[model samples]
Target chain A: MNVYLMIAVCSAVTLVPRILPLFVRTLDSLPKTIRKCMLLLPIAALGCLIFPLSLTDFSSSWYAGLVGVVAAFLSSYFRRPMIISIIISLVLTTLMLVLFP
Target chain B: MNVRRKSKAFQVLFAVAGECEFDENLIYSIAKHSHFWKNLHGKGIVLMQESTLCAKDGMKDGFPIFLGYFTTALAFGLLTRTSGLTLVQGVLISLTNYAGSGQFLMMNLYNAGSFLFEIALSVFFINSRYIFMSASLYPHLIDKKSVVKRILIGFGVTDENFAVSSLKGKMLPFPYMMGLIFTAYSGWVSGTFIGFVAGNFLPPVVQKASVITVYAMFASLLGGEVRRNAKALLVLLVSGLSNSVFILLVGIPTGFSFLLSMLLATAFACFIYTDEEVFGV
Candidate 1:
């Protein structure tokens, strides 16, 4: 695909969902359960985003990625900022890779 | 791990770029100086109002997020260059799409030689959460914005902007939202450009190490969410385990596995976890 076309298509698909609601004011009229589901969508969607794909794919060293995951989990769970948590994990992972490789 | 399965770009992009927002001090200053300020002042005693047009505050809100976006977007550019895309394409993706996960998916799919329809479908599904976010935020927006202004704001409604505005808990002013989005947008695009130019200059070892950023971002993002909402831990485990099983054991296609796992996890969360339990204190 032409890169421009790809970007355009992706932009359109993303913008449609975001912009459509601005025009449609009846969203409040949606059923209660549906609204609740919408509220919960983030957790579920985020769950699907990280697993099996990011946490497990350690081609060079699984141990490196595992340590990174643990570090990330601990830092984030302690409510550290997102960037700090990520940096901690990266540092740990890099150390492991350097040591093990 | 299969090289195809090692699509860290999409997963990392989605994880960190998902929930972000910043303060609106800079925009308030601009709006205060603009002709729009005259209209804002004409309506009432601007000083007495809870939300003054001269609200030259909250500038620090997005600074932290800006740093995060800069690093991730930089990583994104480096990854794109490594993935065989030119600098222009990487920058264009950030500038136009403004959706990190979608851009990553597009590049990953393009590299994998997937057809346009398949790429579109995967992106659509991955970003489907935006529809819900928009709907949930609909009630919180001010009623006075014109259609054009609303459309513009809507385009700027990334996960970060939405999360920040929702936390503030009021009708978001157009200028404020614009300021927040524009800051983030600039950070992302500029970071990508810098990464592209400097990507090759990095040592080979540093370049190899940069790939771990995606997984680190993912784990950190998930950790934050799970901490806030403990049930989200269950949701994460369920979806992650299911997706792994479906993709690894059952040999389901990546796209299908992701959608199925997401759908199942969302449905389960909806049925089992109440809003108070999951989102409430």
Candidate 2:
């Protein structure tokens, strides 16, 4: 596929679901069971994302990912703000790369 | 004349007194009848109110959260460029191919000279989960709105936005969700552009290192969900085991391996946990 066309098409396709609610009038009226399932989708997707990472060969990237995971978990466990958790994880990951290198 | 003036002053005082009494009584009545005050006494109401407030706050707070997503897009762009994609191609990938996993997988497959069918299947499998995500979010959407708006908003429902919006425990207003989506969309596209442009300047090692950002963000998101639903613990275990076994034994394509693992995990969860009330349709 032409890269530009491919990107545009894929971006449009992805955006479709993301922006669906803008046209709808009532999001809360959907079936309860459906909403329940939707709640689990993120976790499922997240699993897919990290699964590949874990399998990759050991490298600075893997180590950085480990640090980030720990930092994110700790911050989240303590109920720190999302932004804080992300910042801490990123900073920790970056530092691990610098220090270990 | 003096009597008339005194009567007028008395009338003005009485009017002031009447207004004060009316205001006080109105306040008392509202305190007794308003849902806000009533909710203070009801556990369910209090929980609902709190969740509503949280959702509202989350919508407002979505901007900063999306910055991480932007970084992930940047990393993806960097990877894509190194994989032989042009700068424009990288930008298009970020904009059109908004799916983080699918795009990454496609890039990897492209490098391997995978067959068209293989690539298509991988994309379908990775994106299949969205069918479920969309189904779940469908009810929370404003179904009565214009089709154009619905389609537009639906496009932005990535894992990040979906998770944040779902936690709000209420259907977010369309405008608010738009704000969140647009902010994230901009971040992703811009990040990709920057990453592609900068990819040439960075060493191969540095470019490779950047890939970890996506993994880190994914870990955080996964960890958050796992903490909430112990069921996810089972899913993670099953997925990890299944992927490893498939890789070792079957030697299926990488994308297919992931798809099979996810399906196996979901099926296992469905069968093992028969309590429909807990697992849902």
Candidate 3:
């Protein structure tokens, strides 16, 4: 497959959904239940984003990604500022890999 | 966490940024300069009316997201390089597709030597969730006169900007939204560039460790959501479980598994949680 053509194809497909909603103003007309479901999509999507993927993110280290997840889970539990928790996770995960490896 | 004042010219900051850094002197100076100072001097408190959140302000609002995206994209750049893409192609992906997960899926497919059609199909399904986000955001961009601005804003809408604006629960100006998106977009692109170019100087060990950085972001975000909303736990469980099952046992593609997990969780959440419980603003 042509790499540039593949990039174009992927970019084109990606734009369709992101840009399609701009032209359509259907939120107000939707049913209450449907609206609620639509609104809930982010959380559901977030859930899918984290699991299985996080575990598989590390190509070389098996538990490095898990360590990052755990660091994030523990540090963010107190409702800390967004960056603080992430930095903590990054530092800890990096340290784990560097030391253990 | 709301504070009400009975006196005139009383103002309260929501402290959504987790800092209640309201200085009386600063407020007075800003109020003295703003036109709303006169309208609000002897009237009741109105938060949005007093300050015009311009593009500059939006950039300020988006600073956190910018910082996060920079680090996350750095990791992405490193990962892409290791995944056998050149710096230019990695940058190309970041440039054209601002959506994170979709780009990751694209790289994965491309690396796996998947056909263009398959890559396009998977990316389409993975990114389709943005439809709901953009549709939900339609209510806020209700200004009819600025169709061009609306289109631009819609193109730039990411999860962070959308969350920040929606948390305000008001119609935001076009400049502010653009500012937020531009700041975040710059961070993402620049980070990728630096990570690919400068990241080449990073020790191989550090490069290997960087893959966990993006996951760290998602974990923290989900943690924050769980802290705020009670039912986020259930959403997390069902969606995560279903996605794991679909991908692991059923052997579906990651993109399709993601979509199914999202729908199942959304349906489950709607049936169980009330409107107020599900909607956090």
The two-chain DockQ for each candidate, comma-separated, is 0.47, 0.33, 0.49
lDDT of 1 by residue, B100-179 (tens): 66776566556545566767776776666566566556654554368887787788777665655544423466666666
First chain TM-score in every candidate? 0.79, 0.63, 0.71
Model 1 chain B, poorest ten-residue lDDT window? B22-31
Best by DockQ: 3
Stretches off by above 4 angstroms in model 3 are A1-14, A56-61, A98-101, B1-65, B100-148, B160-180
**Model 3 lDDT per residue over A39-91, tens place:** 45655666777777776666556687788887886666675554566667777
TM-score of 2: 0.59
Q: Considering the two chains of model 3, state its CAPRI-style docking category.
A: medium
Candidate 2: residue B187 lDDT (0-100): 76
Off by over 4 Å in 1: A55-57, B1-51, B54-65, B100-119, B132-146, B165-173, B279-281
Better of 2 and 3 by TM-score: 3
Summarize candidate 2's per-residue lDDT along B1-281 as a digit string, tens digits.
23432453343223213211111112211212222322333454333222233334544545554565566566677777767888877776766766776686666555545555556655655554454445445544443256766665577666555544443434456666677667767877888888788778976555545555455545554554555456766776787667767665677766566667766665655544434423322
**Model 1 — TM-score against the truth?**
0.75
Q: How many steric clashes between backbone atoms does each model show?
A: 2, 34, 0
lDDT score for residue B80 of model 1:
80
Q: In candidate 2, which residue ranges exceed 4 Å CA deviation?
A: A1-42, A45-54, A57-101, B1-62, B65-68, B99-145, B159-180, B200-203, B271-281
Q: What is the Cα-based lDDT of residue A20 in candidate 1?
A: 82
TM-score of each: 0.75, 0.59, 0.70
